[model samples]
Structure formats: C-alpha cells, structure tokens
Target: MAEATEKKAKTKKKSANQTLVIVESPAKAKTIEKYLGPGYTVKASMGHLIDLPKSRIAINVEDNFQPEYITVRGKAKLLKELQKDAKKSDTVLLASDNDREGEAIAWHLKNAIQDKTEAKIGRIVFNEITPVAIKEAVKNPGEIIEAKVNAQKARRVLDRLVGYNLSPLLWSKVKNGLSAGRVQSVALRLICEREEEVENFLPEEYWTLDADFVKGKSSFTAQLVTYKGEKPVLKSESDVNNIIEEIKNAECKVVGIKHTDKVVRPKAPFTTSKLQQSAANKLGFTSRKTMQIAQQLYEGVNIGTSRVGLITYMRTDSVRISQTALDEVRDWISKNHPEDLPAEQIQYAVGKGAQDAHEGIRPTYVTYTPDSVKEYLTRDQLRLYTIIWERFVSSQMNNAKTRTTSAEIQAGDAVFRVSASKIVDKGFYRVIHLLSSKEDSTGSLPALKEGEALSATKFYPEQHFTQGPARFTDASIVKTLEEKGIGRPSTYAPIISVLLDRYYVTRVNKQLVPTQLGRMICKILVESFPDVINETFTAEVENDLDSVEQDKLVWNNMIGDFYTPFKNRVDEVMEKQESVKGFLDETTDKICEKCGKPMVKKLGRFGFFLACSGFPECHNTRSIPLAKCPMPECNGEIVARKTKGRGKEFYGCTNYPTCNFISHFKPVDQYCPKCGWFMVEKYDKKNGSYKSCINPDCDYLHSVTEAVEEAQKEALAKENQALKLAEEASKENQD
Candidate 1:
C-alpha cells in the first residue's frame, strides 16, 4: 500500500508541472492552444471575472474614490474553475487583450487567484493572435502595468460618479428612467444644438444656368462661371432668365485651354475612427456593427486547417505599423505588383493624442489574401478583409499620376468653365482604386483647340436652395466625436448606442434626430450642469485620463478634481431644479375606459404610450395609434411597439392574434396610388428620404420634398415662438 501511494504521488507531481494560460475568450484560447501544443493548458476567463457591480454605484467617495470590485454575478463558477486549474498548475499566465481595460482585468485575475495557488502568476500580451506572436509572448512574460490599470479605474470611477449622481436628478427633473453620462451628455448637447440650428435656418433660393455644348461628336455640360465679367451668384430664377436671355443668341467658342499634371498619394492605414467612417460610407454599417465585425476578425478565424487572427488589434488610434508587417507587405507588393512598389518604404505619422500602444489595424498575414480565405468567412468578413488588405498594400505603393485639362468657353458676356482628368499612371490605384469612389479611367472630354467653335445643343436652368447643415448620421457623428476628442477608440460606438437605446435619440431617415423628449432633456441638462456637460470640459477630462495612463498624473487626484465640483453642482440642481415631467405630455381626445379619465400621450422607456391623466387613482396604459391598418376590411389600427429583448421599434396591428401585420419601418398614413397598399417612410444615405409602397408587387415611390417644405414652414413659426419665450424668461430673471 505504501508503494502504491508513492506511485500515485509521482503521477500527481508530473501532472501538476504543466503551465496554464488564461485568455479573455474561448476563440482566442483555442487558437493559442493549437499554437502551443504540449504541456500547456489554455482556458478562457470570458472577460472580467471580477468587476464593479452594476446594480449600484460601487465607489467610495470618501476614500479617494476607491471602487468596490466584486466577482461579477454569474461568473463565480468560472472563477472557481480558473482557481482550481491554477491550484493544480505551477504557472498561470493572464493573456487578455492588450489595452488598459485588459490590464485591469489581468490585475484583478492575479489578485483573485494568487492566494488560491502557489503558482507564479504573470501577464502576456500580443496584438495579433498568431503562432509567432503567441510564442514570443510566452517566451517573455511580464507583470501587469499598474499605470494602465489605474487609468482604467480612474475613467470608471469618474463615469460612475457623474452618471450615478446626475441620472437620478434627471429622473426627478425631466422624466423617470432618463439617464445622463459624462461623455454621452456632451454628444447629446451637440445633437440638440444642431437641431436648433436646423430649426432656425432659413433656406435661400438659388439658380444655376447650364448649357450642353457639342464639339467633334462629343457632348459636355458646363456651368456659367462668370457673367458680365464678374462671378455670378444667381439668387433667383429671374436672375437666371435675365442671363439666359442675354446669352441666348451669342456664339460659343473655346477661347482658352490649360493643362496640368498632378500626383495623388495613398491614405494612411486604418485607425479606429477612419475605419468606422469608411465602413459607414462605403458599406452602410453603423459604428457598432463595424466594431463587432472587426472584433471577430481580430480574434481568431478559421482559415482552413487551423484558426488564426486575420487582423491586428482594431481599437487603436495610432496609424503606425509594425516593422515586421511593413517589410512583409513591401516584399509582397514587390513580387505581386512590381511597378507599383515605391523606392523606399512609407511610414504614416501618428496623431498628437495617440498613446501608440498597438500598431494600426492591418492583416496579420500578407499572403492570406481575401480571395484565398473567402470560403471560410462570411460575406461581410470577406469585404472588410479585402479592403484592409488593399489599403495596406497600396499605402506602400508609388504615387498615381494624372493630367487635368481646363477649358474656358466664351458665350456673350458669360464664361463657362469645364475640366477633365486622365490617369497617367495607375501606381497605387492599381490596387486601391477598386475600393475608392473615384475610378482610374480617363474622364470624358472632347479634344478641342483654342478658338474652336462649339454648337449649343440645349440651354438648361436648375433651381436650387441653400441647404441647412445636414443632420448627423452614424458616420458623421463618429467623425465629429473623434475630431472633438470627446471619446476614445472603444467608447465611440457605445456612446451612440446608449443614446439610441435610452430613447434619447432616434434614427430618422438614417439621420440622428432629437425627439421631443430628447430636446427637453438636453435643455434641462445644459441649463443645470453647464460646466460639466460641455465639450471643452469633457475633452479635458479625456486628456487627463490619458495622462493618468502614462503615469504623469495620478488617478486619485484626477477623480478628486472632477468629483468635488461635480457633486456640488448635482446637489444644487437636485434642490433647485423644477420638475418638467408633464411638460412634454400631449393630451389626446381618447378617454381611458378603466378610469373614465382622459388619455394623454406620455413618453416611456420604449416610446410614446397612452396613459391615464389620473395616474395615482387610475393606472391604465396602451400603445398609441399611429395609422389605420391597410389590410382588406380588417378594421384594425397600427400602433408603434418594440421587440422583447432589444426594444427595437416596429409598427404592428393592434389585433395581433387575429390579424398579422407588422413592419420595421413606420407606416405612413397614405396609400399607394397604383396597388392601394400602405406606404412607409424610408431613408438611405444615397437616396435621402422618401416614401415607398409596402406591397411587394407594387413599386410606387414618392419623394418627401413637399412634406419637408411644410416642416420648414412650421419650424420657422416655432422658432419665433421660442425666441419670444426666451426673451420673457430673460426679463423675469432681470426683475
């Protein structure tokens, strides 16, 4: 029996000698495990095992804003498994993401599992999950950086203090279930201020005169640039008619011609913001969707025999590329497209505010082209990877050469100018032009000499209006946020998402429009917390957070500086601010059957609903009617409703069990002229706003330009009323 026990002890000792590696996700772990084959066990932590609780504000304001970190609920079993594995192994390496949040996660993991085992706990980081990167990280394990962890803690504490304190005040003052954030509030203000601008803007009428000219079997159209030897600003159709009448009988000729050669260089590799904007414009993807797809690409994706990370870290501001990647790409370009290769390698400039923690987003392997791995990826994955590959390869290529020719045509007292460009050398355009909006083909222009006669085919006059500033879309908002330094790479997508999820903003016609409740909330927040909710102050806080990450500033001091004044302001607002809860409620003609009280349209978490005016005495609510159902003699009403889990808005019939009618787009009150089907409002970045028939068989479409004109008129009247109110309020303050 003693001999048997000795053998079992020897077997246990051998088994306990293996090293355990912990990662943030199972996908990453599986890739690393395949790379590091024997004697190394890889397990996933599934993100942070211990984090601040979400139910309440878990910060100690008296203790220099210390956070009360706890094991995230539902993660206790996972933590135990990690501890058990650590107890059996002699070494444990925390291989989470390579960022400040990842560093904090690693630090928390070490502290939690360190006491449970005698194993050596360390940290390993790699931007890309490939065999080379993983092996190198394992060969040189390091400790978690304290400064990064502190920076993450400072941001979390600061956000908690601001959000937790201000949200309740907003609930009391504005409406229940409303929320506010340090960065998100600033974004809200931007949107609301823009909406005010749009409301107050008065569009001026404008006109332009154009004529089609034919010369040598080629036709071209050119705008009249100068009239009567001066630049024209035709503000009215009368002005356009006067010019057209003057130049109608004049002989047109190309009096002068000029040619110039130009060179166009490639753009830098993908930064987080640039990638989001490009995807939004080119692929019609929201920032949130782009990041989600990017995350999957960064994590390991199966390429045939094994899984490998297709791209480097996606959430980076730096445009810097690794030397190893640069060399490989340069070599690949030289062999694949030798003429496009530049004499020297190109390196992009890093931004002023970039921490330069990771290289810019690029493919991990140059040879694994998009076409080679097309079978393994989804359609979106293939498209995104193709662009990344094309961009990286073309960024290091030679400049594209083009020749532009400008012609000035003289007609009576007006000068019409036209220009055309022809590509001299494809260069980088050989690879990148496929993805760019601009093509490499030579422009269409007829060859003409100086003093050549041209025949006018037709005269055209176009009416136009000076458009107001456009509303923010997913692309423009992300670009604006990045330009103003309001948020970081990881926070950009989530900020927009939170606003939409909370009903603070609604996407109308693919443009973010402030709802009635949203505008009211912004008005209150701007008035109550002007100092903390502005862009400059919020940007300063972001800079200070970055400073803490670099160890130049302490985290506790940063939180103290923001929390003191901010808390005082919150207290003052809570005490002094008047409630505007019922101000936005619109009294409707419908009566509540349950309480015999008038029903009013009130804003709820999901959307507008009909609530009884007598709230305490009689509680009754139902979906507000939007339009009549278009089914054949169904006798049902369409109402706005939301989905179960995500609360996404949809319009459906009130008689759901009996009559099944639903649509993602809001139903319009009008019917299609041809098929008699109901119409729905739709918006796209390319097509602007319009109404379309809901029937699959009917293709009736109509532009909403007339509706927009009516809205503008209404907005002008409302603007005058708002100005009068402001003046009265000012007078009251003065008295």
Candidate 2:
C-alpha cells in the first residue's frame, strides 16, 4: 500500500504539469501540436464521442423532450483514450469547429471527460489553423457556449422527431425504405414541382429579326426593337417577314445615339453557399464535393516545412471580412497590383440572420499564392484555392469602368437598335477576366450624326421557342435554398446528398431530376403533411433554431410546439392511408425459370429490380439489363448498377467477377464508325446531348473534339461577322 501511494503521488505530480488539447480531426491535431510544442499532448476526437442512438428516437418526449445521448457506436474506445489522456494532464482544451455543431461536440467532450480526470476543462476556437492563430487561441480560452449547444440540440431533436415519426408512415403509405426529413423533403418538393412545370409546359414559337447596316467605314448589326413608334412583339413568321419586306427596301438613317459610362462593382467575397455555387459553375464540382475539399483546406495542408490551413472556416454565411484581413489584402494589392487598389478599404454587408462568428472564406496567408503552393495541393485543391484567393483579392480592388453606346436606326416604320460596350478600365476585372467567358468587344458604331444615311447589307430572321423552367442544378438549388432560408451553410451539401442517396432525385446533365418514385412520395407528403414539407414552415423552424442559439427561445418548448401537431398528423395518416408497399409492383413479361411464374418489377432501396412473383417458392432477383457489353470477346450484358453510398448510377457488365467492364456513362447500342467501339451518351448543360466512343484510345473521341471545335467556330463566326460588316462599311465610307 505504501509503494502504490508513492507511485500515484508521483503520477499526479507529473500530470499537474501536463496539458492536453482535443480537436475534431487528426489533421487539425497534427498542425496544432506543432504550434503548441512540447508539454502538451494534442489528440483528435474524430467528431462527436456521444450522439443520440440511431436505433430509436432516444428522446423523452413527455419529459421536456430531454435527449438521451449515449456513447456513439464504435466511439467507446476513442472516448476511453480521450479520458486517459485527460487524466494525465492538468488542463484539457476542447478545440472543435467554430459553429453550433462544433459547440455541441465540445460540450459533449467536456461532459464525457471531466468525470474521469481532475483536469480543468475549457474551449478554444480558431477560424484558421496557423501558428499565430493557435497560439492566440491557447492563450485565451473560453467556456463552451450553452446557447449554441442547445440550438444544435434543438435542431437534432427536431430532425429526429420529423424523420423518426414520419419515415415509418411513408413506409406504410408509400413504399418500404422511403424516408422524410425536415429540410430534405422540402428540397424534394422543389424538384418535383419543377419537373411538373416542365412536363406541363407548352412551347410557343416566336421570331427575331436582325439587320446588318453600314455606318461610315464600320459595319454593325442591330435588332428590330420598335415598329410604328412602339416596341414590337413578333409572334409569327409572317409578322417577321412583313417587317423584313418593309425594311429591306426602305432607306435607313441613324435617328438617335446615346453613350453612358458605367462602373461594375466586384462581388462580395465567398460565403459557403456562394462558394458551392461558384465551384459548381466554374469547376464542375458537386456541392458535397465542394464541402469535402473546403474541409480539407480548412483543416490543414502540408506545405514545404510545415502544415498550414489554406483558408478560413468555409461554412460561413457572412460576407463581412475582418478589418485586419481587409487591411492586409489591401496592402498586398498596393504592393503587387498598385493600379487595382482602391483608395479605401472595401466593406461588405452581413446578410440578415447571419451568425457572423467568422469572416468570409479567404486564404489564411496572402503570400501563399495558388502557384506558390500548387505542388503541395491536389488539382482540385489548387482550383478551389485559386478561386478563393482571386475572389478575396478582387473584392478589395476598384470597380471596373465601362462605356456603353446605343444607336437607333430608322427603316420605314421599324426601329433597329444596336448596343455595344467597351472596357474603359480593367480594375478588379484584371484578375477575374482570366476566369470569365465574356470577351470585350471594341466594335462600336463609327462616329455617327442624327439623320445620317445608312445602307442595309443583310437581313436575318431566326425562329425561336420559349423554354420551360429549368431543373435545379447543385448550384441553383443551393442558391434557392439559401435565399429561401431553408438550410444553412453546413446543411446544404448534406441535404443534397441525402436526396441523392434516397433515390428521390437523380442528376442528369448535372440537373436534378425527380424520379417517378420521388414525385409520388412528394405528392403524398405535400397532400398529407403540408406543414412539415412546406418551405415557409421549414424556414420558420430554422429561424426558431437561431432564436434558441440567441437565447430568445427555449429549445424544448420549440420542439414540443412543433411535435404536437406533427405527431397528430402522422397518426392520422397512418390510420387513414392504405399500404402502398406492393402498389409499385408490376408484372413483367419474363417468367421465372424454376417456377414458371411471371416476374414482377419492384422498387428496392437502390432502384427497380426484377423479382419472381412467387417470392418464397422461387426467390430470385436480377438486375435489369441496359445494354450489351462493349468489350471485345465479352458476351456479358451491361446492367445498371448504383454506387454503394451515394447511389449514383453507372453501367457495368453482368459478369462483373469475370468481365470486369464498367462505364460511368450510360452505354448506347450504336458502335462508333471509326473505331468500332460502343458509343455512350455524353451531356453538357450548354451543348444539350451527344454520343461519344467508350474506348479512350478511339478516333471517334476526336470527332467529339471536332464537334466542340465546330460549335466554337459557330459562336466565333457570329462575332466575326459583325466585325466584318463594320470593316466593310468603314472601307465603303473611305472610298
């Protein structure tokens, strides 16, 4: 007993001088450990150590909706390790993220570890992972915010109530494996509604008339704008032809000329929603992919001699940049881009209800340019970081100056107008112009006076049809959700991922298209549980959560008020609706080999599959074939398969164990004429759709390249034709 007491005393003395820090990720721990140096042990919690159980609701609804949190599955060992480390340290710092989720994680860690150790517990948060930032955070630590924890708890309980209470109702009323969410269902409703709008749209044909005219030595094209002193709407070819006939013979003269100088301001630095949208449009990245890459950049990237976080916290909705960051970036501009620097620092407004806990997404260090660290980053990381750097730099630069000219030419009773713009100063555009697709056109109408005679060169009329409402892309959906206040910066990506995983929506040509099952489920939820899947209600609930975070509302009270009506509706639907589990099953033409019974098409968790009608007697199921295998000497048929987690569809051979042929693109029946390889459908948002050879080494792929070139040529031809007409007119005037 005397020896044991001495050892315990020695251990306690050693631990009194030690400190431990816990973070959410190992990458963060490694970077922070380096910054903290010796005498401190840094560890990663790998996210939450405790969460509500997945097997049940785990909420005591009758007892003020108190949550029952247990050690998360597979995290017991991690929790033990964290406690052991805490026991050997005098102080424990919980350094998670800087948001509500992070606050909840820190609170949970403190509660779990405090009982096992005598260490004093505190919380520290830093938007960026850098030596300076870490040292500052360690020097000044704070307690976990109880309000933020309650807000996160409120969101969790609300989601659990909606998901757990409503999912079983869907399984009974619609189909098995069907689920609903507080935010995801509203997103599904948006997509399904858009699909309906598209299906029900009727096309209306219209015509546009353009006239080529010569002014002095310059030629330019103008669109017919006004007829008989009023703006004209040409609805038919006859209307267009009549105007063309009248204008083709009439002597035209310049009637009016106007010039205006305008200044174009730079966009605010990236918020989470804006970053997701920009990455989708510029880099062809999905929202989930964007968030994943941003997380990596926020955690830390290994540079030459040290590890450093490339950007600030990415999951921020505020566009407000810190005064220090603004001053530093302006200094960089004054030194590197002297001509582009503004006289004063640029400030952006914070959006309504923004947390404003962190600054907008920007590079941590201005000197770590994308090129300087390109070798340390993957291709995706480089692209993302480049945009962040450019956006932040440009946000502090002067506005772009442009001069626009508008000319009106009168031909009989028709008025044709041409407008052109020239950049007077590049300013911030000097940096962003490299990323833009728009070309600056200097081809303006030559100096013209009122009543100057102009000769018509050519008349072109084109037919057009009104387009239907566009389907949601990852970018557009995130923008809409943010605008509607349906989800926050962190929830947008996960909401999209959940919808995709549930097979409620599929991406075609990068557009979200609701499946038949998705539409059906949407109809049921919209009709039965209008409050839950409603956009306004969802937005209100988000506001309520924010109120909880601000201490303006009680979390339990909000959940109780919401659950009363929600639970009543669930019970009503459960008692009223008929079972739709087998409603989707349809008899197929193929017969089972063993029982001779006909097969039935049924929806599974992944998608539709062919199953024997006599289930127990002849239990057989097979994937539906899409096309024949494209590989040479392969007799296997290609079948539609889904990815394991996200459920993204791809084509693979039925004999996968042997043939092992797979294609990300859907296979077509036609073979390439040049290479004899099978063709697959390829999609582009602008180019619509086309087919390409599946073989990477096939010459047919070159044909696609040629097609793209031809499209580019066509676009360029339009621009060149306008310039050529101006040149011809200039030459005519000179003669």
Best by lDDT: 2
Q: Give stretches of model 2 more than 4 Å off.
A: 1-16, 215-218, 436-438, 442-449, 623-735
What TM-score would each prediction reach against the true structure?
0.89, 0.85
User: lDDT at 481 for candidate 2?
Assistant: 97
Write the residue-wise lDDT of candidate 2 on 1-735 in tens digits.
Answer: 999999999997765578899999998888889889988899999998899999999999989999999999999999999999998888999999999999999999999888999989999999888888888998899999999999999999999999998888887877777788889999999999988897665555678999999976789899999899888888878999998887788999999999899998998999999999999999999999999999899888899988899899999999888777888888888898898887888888999978788889999998888879999999999999999998998999999888989999999999999998888888897777344535565556778788889999999987765666888999999999999999999999999999988888988888999887888888888989887798999999989988999999999999988889888888998999877767789888978877889999998776778999999888998887667777888888788888999977788998888899989998777777887767888877543446888888875752333544555677799999999999999999999
Tens-place lDDT digits, model 1, residues 369-402: 8878999999998878888878877899999898
* lDDT, model 2: 0.88
Q: After superposition, how far is residue 521 of candidate 1 from its true place, in Å?
A: 2.0
Tell me, by TM-score, which candidate is best.
Answer: 1
- Give the C-alpha miss distance for residue 233 in model 1, angstroms: 1.9
Cand. 2 TM to true fold: 0.85
> Model 1, stretches more than 4 Å misplaced?
1-16, 436-438, 593-596, 613-620, 627-638, 641-735
Each prediction's total of clashing residue pairs, residues at least 3 apart in sequence or on different chains, is 0, 6
Residue 472 of model 1: what lDDT?
A: 92
